[model samples]
Target chain A: MNAAFALIARDVRLAWRHPNEIATILAFFVIAASLFPFGIGPEPQILARVAIGIVWVTALLACLMSLDRLFQAEVEDGSLDLLVTAPAPLELLALAKVVAQWITTALPLIVISPIVATMLHLPADGYATLLLTLVLGTPGLSLFGGIGAALSVNARRGGALLALIVLPLTVPILIFAVAAVDAAIAGLSPRPHLFLLAGLSVFALTIAPFAMAASLRQAAE
Target chain B: MNWHRFASPSNFKRLSARIFPWAAGGAALCLGCGLYQALLVSPPDYQQGQSVRIMYIHVPAAWMAMFVYANLALAGAATLVWRHPLAEVAGRAMAPIGAAFTFLCLATGSLWGKPMWGTWWEWDARLTSVLILFFVYLAYMALNNAFDDATRGARASAVLALVGAVNLPIIKFSVDWWNTLHQPASVMRLDGPAIHPSMLWPLLAMGVGYTLLFVVLALVRIQAELIERRLGALVQARLSAEPAA
Candidate 1:
């Protein structure tokens, strides 16, 4: 447990030291969401209808963009070996990295989502539900994305391959998250969709760490 | 029958060779009968008319898509848990075949849907999940070959398969909850089949035929993979034995 916290702290500190990485991801999230209006026209109703989906998808893409560096830096600097060989459980360490990643990347995206939602003309009723879905769904993204990062860390083509591996797995999260917000915007109860989103996060949490650990062990081998 | 003995690559090779002929012959017989019955003997649907014939292929291929993924995951388990060389080869060999079946399912489904659902595609729950399943298979194949080191690729992809296995049920459930337009199970229901026997028989025959065909293809692919690995090993051995190049 202490080791997990230390791992989290170390990762957070490292991320803090390089503020540009976080800034870039946040910029990508905002810029990518803004591009949808240009692509499809700035019609308020059309933008409102697609606001949640656009935000969710662009956020997913931004998260994916950041995932390439998740373990690449560790692998290159040789700290991955130290982490693997440490007395701390690798699964716990894996979870720590995921948590750290969520804190650095997804959390910021979540914080900025409402502003993007507003710019996209999302229904006022949806702001809360959008934030709720982002909070619930982004961790699942990071968890599954961590598995992709670890698996592809040693691969020749990491970026495209990581997206290919991770995107399909994230379908459930995207469905539930978008549905929850859409339901809220339509004046329907978002509870059921929110429950499913939460369920997916829990499921990913339980399953992803061990997968990450196994893939890391193989990559480090 | 001692299973452990056959875990050895050479022994497994011999066993697969022995089984290949039987599997291939059975596949030939079943597929011939199935096609005959499906195309000629089976009654057309009351609602769909002759277009219902596509179900004979679509349903079986869809079943094979899921079945092959399940087998691949099981093979992945064998590879990771036992570090069985044959399991690694088998997993690598099965991925593309599974992807092909998944593609067949999607293509045939689209053909049937155009005449029935009046659209080539719908974001129906089952269809969407199956599409995602197709993507998963593609991802598995991509990951399996991404690395230069064969063992590392195998191990990494094995972990991925296991992760995908864990997600498959969730994806199925979530998508079903989201929305559904595709018909529910007609044959595998607890209250026996809802499909008529005239259609059922041919579909079942085709299902069996497809499974047998998969077995034959798998055996052949595994044999090829083993031989390829042996060739690689021999080349490596000769290169090492040559001293400074």
Candidate 2:
């Protein structure tokens, strides 16, 4: 557990040095959300209807955007070999890194979501559910995106390839997140969709670290 | 008589060369008879008329799409667990073929949907699920080729295929739920309501034919990949021997 904290602290410190990584992801999310109105007409009703979907999708994309560098820095600097060879469990360490990644990336997306929500003219009633769903959903995005990051860390042009590998897998989270917000707007019980989103997060948390560890070990080999 | 002998690449190559002809023959015979039965003899549906003929191909292709992914996942497990070289080869070689079948399923389904549903595409549960499956295949193929080192690429992709296996059911479930919630004016029949014996026979025959066809293509492609790897190794060896002219 101490070793896992150490890993998390180290990753958090590294992310602090490169604060632009988190900034770029947030900027991307805001920009992407705003693009929908121009592409389609900027009517309030239309944008309000699509606001949750656009926010969820662009947030998903922003999570994917930062995934490329999740392990590349460690792998490139040869620290991944040290991490693998450590007495501490690599899977535990991987989970820590993933937690740190979510903190730096997805957490900010959750924070900035309301501003984008208001900009896209989201119904005031939907805000609570939007926040609730993002809280539930972003962790799953970070976790599954970790698997993609580890698997493609050794690839050329890995960012684009990472998107291809990760986007399809995140469809369920996207669907449920949007559904929960939509249900809230419709005055229906959002619990079922929220529960499913939470379920997906727990599933990702359980499996992603081990999968990342396996892929990281293979890439090193 | 030992089954493990086929695990050896040379032995596998030789056996596959011999087996390909028979698989191909079986595929051809089944396809010929199935298409004849489907197009010429099977009664047209009272509801769909001639468009029902597309079912003979679309349903079978969809079945093969799912079957190939499942087999590929098993092969991926074999590769990862036992470091079985042949299983790695099979997994790598089967991905594109599986993707093609998935693409065929989508295309034919689109063609079938137009006449029946008034729209070329619908976010219906089964169609959406299959579309996600196709994206999964695309991701697998991209990951398989992305690395500088071929073996590492294969191993990474094997891990990916395994992860995809774990997610497949959840994806299907979510899409089904979404469809039920939306319930957009249901038009196309999901199970044919009641499949007549005449339509069912040809469908079964076509499914068998498609599976056999996939096996033959996968064997041929796996052999080609093995030879390609060997040739790459040989070229590397010869270049090292020449010593920087």
Candidate 3:
């Protein structure tokens, strides 16, 4: 537990030292979300209808963009060797890394989603539901995306490969998140969708750490 | 006489070489017979008319997509647990063939959907899930080739294959849920033995043919990958033996 917290703190301090990384991620989310209106026309109805999907998708893309960075720096600087050989359990360490990723990547997206939601003219009532689902869903994204990041850590050109490897695995999260928000918009109960999202998050959290650790071991070899 | 002896690269190579010709020939024969039965012998669907014929290709292709992935995951498990090099080779060899069948399934499904569902695509559960399966295949193939060292790439991708195996069930459940949720009247209804006995036999034959083709292709590719790696090692050994220039 102490080792995990220490690792998390180390990652957080690194991010704090370079705030621009977080800023770029947030900016990318906003920019990607903004492109939708221009591409799909500025009509209010269409904009509102697509607002949740656009935010979720852009958030997903933003997660992918940062995922490669998750292990790339460690691998390049050769610290991954230390992590691999550390006495602390690798799975716990992997979980710590994913937690740090959620803090740095998904947290910012959650913060900025409402503004993007407003810019896209989403109904005010949907804000709470959207936030609820994102809170439940983004951890899954970080964890699963961690698997992709670990798998691609050794690849020379991994961005497109990372997307191909991660996006399909993320389809369930996307589906449930969108369903919950869509239900809210349509004046229906989103309880089931939210429950499903929760289920996925729990499942990802349980499995991703071990999987990432295994992949990291392979990459380090 | 233990079967495990064949797990060695050299023995597997000889075995695959021996089986390749027979599997290929059987696949060819089955494909010919199946197509003949499907096109000429089976009666047209009373409702879908000629378009129903696409099922002879599409359904089997879809089945092979899922079947190949299941085998790939099993091979992945074998690689991870026992570090069997042939398992890794088979996993690598199967990826592209699985992806091609998935593409065929999607394409032929689209062609069939156009004349029947009036749209080239629908977000129907089965179609959507199968599409996700295709993505899974692409990801597996991409991850498998991404590393510099062959063993490292294969092991990394084997881990990935096991992890992504979860997607299969999610796709299945999502399709079932989506189907019930929407339950549209205009969708292609496939409930029971909607297909006649004659059509059924042809479909089964095609299914067998596609499976045989997959086995033959996988064996050939796996052997090729093994031989290529061996050749690479031999060349490296010779080059190293020559000393520094």
Chain A TM-score for each candidate, in the given order?
Answer: 0.99, 0.97, 0.98
Instruction: Give the range of the ten consecutive residues with the poorest summed lDDT in model 1 chain B.
Output: B181-190
lDDT measured at residue A76 in model 1 versus the true structure, 0 to 100: 96
Reference-based TM-score, model 2: 0.96
Q: What RMSD, rounded to one decimal, does every model reach? A: 3.4, 2.6, 2.6
Clashing pairs in 2: none
- Classify candidate 1 by CAPRI docking class: high
Q: What share of the true interface contacts does each candidate keep?
A: 0.94, 0.86, 0.73
Question: DockQ, in order, for the candidates?
Answer: 0.89, 0.86, 0.71
- Weakest 10 consecutive residues, lDDT, candidate 2 chain A? A6-15
Per-residue lDDT of candidate 3, residues B196-220 (tens digit) = 7888898998999999999898987
What candidate 2 gets wrong by more than 4 Å, as runs, is: B1-8, B237-245
Candidate achieving higher DockQ, 2 or 3: 2
Candidate 3 C-alpha lDDT tens digits along A95-199? 999899899889988998999999999987799999999999999899889988888896857888889888988888888888888898889999999999999
- Using DockQ as the yardstick, the better of models 1 and 2 is 1
Look at candidate 3 and give me any clashing residue pairs: none
B1-245: candidate 1 lDDT, tens digit per residue? 43332234677877887888899999999899999999998888777789888988988998999999999999999999998888899999999999999999999888877886788986666677889999999899999999988888888888888999989988898787666413453212212348888888888989999999999999889888878887777777678889795
